[model samples]
Target: MRNARFLWELISYRPASASCRTLFMLACYGERIVFGLAIQAFFNTLPQHTQMTPELFVLFLPWLIAIAVRLIVVNFGTIGAVRFEFSAQALLQHNLFKHILQRPGFQALPDSVGNTISSFRDDTAIVVELLSHLGETCALIIYTSVVFIILLRVNVLITLLVFLPLCCIVVLARQAQKGLEKYRRASRTATSNVTGAIGEIFGAVQAIQVAGAEQHVVAHFHTLNAQRRASMVKDRMLSGALDALFGNVGDIGTALILVLAALSLTAGQIRPGDLVIFLTYLAIVSDFFTDIGSLLAQQTQARISFERMTNVIHGMPDHQLVAHHALHIHDKVNEESAPPAVPQPVVVPLQQLVVRDLCYRYPETGRGIAGINICIQGGTLTVITGRIGAGKTTLLHTLLGLVTADAGEITWNERPVADAAAFFIPQRSAYTAQVPHLFSDTLRENILLGLPEHEHTNDLSTAIHTAVLDHDIAALEHGLDTRIGVRGVKLSGGQIQRVAAARMLVRQPALIVCDDLSSALDIETEQLLWDRLRTSRTQTCIAISHRRSVLQRADQIIVLKQGQVEAAGSLEQLLTTSQEMQRIWQGSE
Candidate 1:
């Protein structure tokens, strides 16, 4: 049922195109029936007239006209089909990617990034191509029905026998369903693995080179390709075998019709003209049945694609893949454009953000934060300090709703934050990761991202200043316009961190969250970063930092140990009262 609904969604995505293409296809096939009738009429009159006559010309003229008219309809249908295919493909890809962005940040993709890309690229096209077949599929069904009725008039028994192959082909397709799906799934998985490995290898090129593991990486890559090649051959071989099987079934059905026709002729119930028409149209009917068989084969594979795509959106309903939204196909593409955001019930200024009895545990390792409670006053710097595996990052992730807490309550300025994921966003709060993501675009564009020019220019200067990026920008060849290589690989580690901080600052978010924001920076730069930020009395921050310099400046510190808060107090108080704090502080020194 979902399969049918999914196809219909794609077909009806562009209603005018669907309707026009259907009508055009019908007229195109209708021409074939007219041609068959003309030829039959010529055969019927041969006994009375040996040569060409006005009657014969009259018989042939409409077929000629139908041929010309079909040319127009077919050309129109082809144009519409091409356009519809592209448009529908774009819509599905857009929706799939959009939903992925809406999901929580901590949820990993269903598979590797490469597998997800395969679903986004290949699966979408497969589904849209199914819609592309609708016009021809529908036309064949109607054409075959009309052809069947004409044959019934000539000899009903043979007509009934013709349908026997159609039934057999359906059964054959049903029987092969499991094999088709299995091979297709294997082939797609193999492709994803290969693609994912290539991406990972490329991203870690420096590491591989430094480790002198290039030969090993190449050997591993070759292994993945070999697996892909084997799976692809199996997948293709099975598809080809099915195609040949369908064609043979149609041929076998035609053979039965031939014997029936001969028997009918001997009984003197069928005329020569009728036999000519039946023999002429038998191939067409056979081909239609073959098409029906192939369509069934496609459905099996399409189901896998549908499953993969829905799985990408965190296992949302399949209908949402084709969910209606403005595509803006005619407009310049906007990164932040909608499908509009879900409206938040309340948007308030940050004063005090509170978390009470928050709990979460990593399912795989069972070493995450539990019963965590914390508070943040607006315009103050609150630092979370802990050793590795202490659930420091996990607690921050819970506060941002990156991971769903097993149990917790969070409030902003005394108002309950029903959805931490949605509530903690730009202009209200912004979180920067330990390793920030930067694009291969101009340094300026990386900071602005999708922000408008007018809006960004207004705040870009202040943001650059506060992030301590002004000096770096001035030293660069193009300053703000410098094109940073992929992931800002062209910049030093510290520059990337500063750029990320500038990006967050440009939004002027009420609350700034960072997970070890200074991990890549030197002492001087790190101090400058904190000093600049501290000057802003209205800026509130929650960051994970074990660096003694950063820890010493915190207004309040939360010390975590084994997923629980070990202590919370000023740095001086913790230095004397908490041994864990002392150890962490010494380790940093």
Candidate 2:
């Protein structure tokens, strides 16, 4: 009953493709039935030896024609099945990626990308084999049932004797099933481990080199490979044993049936030619049933693969609300028409950020920020400082809507940030973290991420100058026309950071929240970055920094201790009035 529901759901979810699958199955079954009946009729008619002349040869013509039709139908069904598998796989991949993009932070599902590749690349074969085997299994079942009924018509007692041994086959098959399940689970885990390792190594090649952990990574890869090899060996050993045992049993049954039919003929209960025909049908039935058991095992493994793929495709992530609002960003092809005006800012009230008894917890570890309350006025360069793991990053993530708060309300301008109203710059800078993805095009094209229609070519030069990267690009061969390599690999860390800054500035966002992006820069460069930020009037900057020089320019400072606010005020007010703040400044001095 449960299996029926699963098939129904699968069909409903993919109706158009399911129709093709149904046609494929029907064609396979039609061919199998026609072929089986023809084979049976051919052997049964051979008992009439008296009239077997040249005219008797005409009886075999229908059998030959049925065999040809069966081949054509089966081939067509196989082709159709393959096409459906490919289309379904593509749809699954697209949906998985789209779902991940909607997930918060996206980093939380580190294995999602690996799962996608494994499902379509590695697991697709399993699905294809499963469908193919299922068609064959269905054909075998139909042929066996028709032949079995014919055997019963000849003699009920003999038919009962034949069924007795099949009971043993079923019991043995059940025992082998346990082993198959164990190995199937092991193989899936090993596959996922290998995929994850490859993705990690390739994605962080630079980090691996800097850390000098190449050998360690290779060693881990070998471990996963060894596990996979061992799992395959286990499955093969068990399957091989079952195959040999089942074959031996089938041989014994065939011998018994032949001996009984010979005895019946000697007793004058049946003719010699009838025994010959019965034995022929017995061979076909035995082979069909034996193959059924093996196909069932393969189906078991395919089921495991299906479950693993679906879990990744269906898993939920944090901050994915019911989506009461939407900020649909369509792919812009070119900048021909006037760029649409940036949508009007979501009008908000209170002129500040309000947090009421907010709480947040990590997925793996329950340890996260607890209840807290605070209000931060807009237009203030608020700086938050705390000890390591004191929830500074967590608070920032919550504010940016990267992580969901366990219990609390964070209202921006008296309204929640339901859409892309603000920009967030993580601690590593966009280039260092996001890899500064650049196409093989001009520098000007790369800077304009979406190319707002209102934007002009001059905006590129303005952004470069404001980011203090004009001299750097001028040193390049083609200036703005120079092509950046994939992920800007040709650029240095500082250059990548500056380029990312320029891209962000091109949007002219209302809010810029930087999480210590200038840590890698020298004092002068950092100072210049702050100077450029000051030139914008309406844009607000909220910085998270512990550096004394960085904090000196902030209009307000908030000290966090043990996940709770310790002090909040201007630098001068905190230095003279708060002991902890005074000590921090004195120590830095």
Best by TM-score: 1
In order, the Cα lDDT scores of the candidates are: 0.85, 0.64
The ten-residue window of minimal lDDT in model 1 covers 338-347
For model 1, the local distance difference test gives 0.85
TM-score of each: 0.92, 0.78
Report the lDDT tens digits of candidate 1 across residue range 474-570: 9999999999998898999899999999999998888999999999998998999999989987889999999988888899999999999999999
Worst 10-residue lDDT window for candidate 2 reads 318-327
Local error of candidate 2 at 282, Å? Answer: 5.1
lDDT of 1 at 130: 69
User: What is the per-residue lDDT of model 2 for residues 1-589, given as tens digits with 9 covering 90 to 100?
Assistant: 4333433433344455445544555554455445445555555666666665765566557667766765676577556665555544444445455565665663435465666677667665675556556555666676677767767777676666876777578676867787788887887777777787788777788888999999998898899889889987887788787787666656766787777877786787765445554666666666665776777677677667666655654555311211112222233657564457456444332257777777778778876677767777765567776566777677776766566566777666676644321323321112212234455566777777657435545766676877788888889999877888756767777777777778767655555666665666678887898788767645666677777887798888877766777788889899888876776676655
Cα displacement (angstroms), candidate 2, residue 305, comes to 3.8
Predicted candidate 1, C-alpha RMSD: 2.9
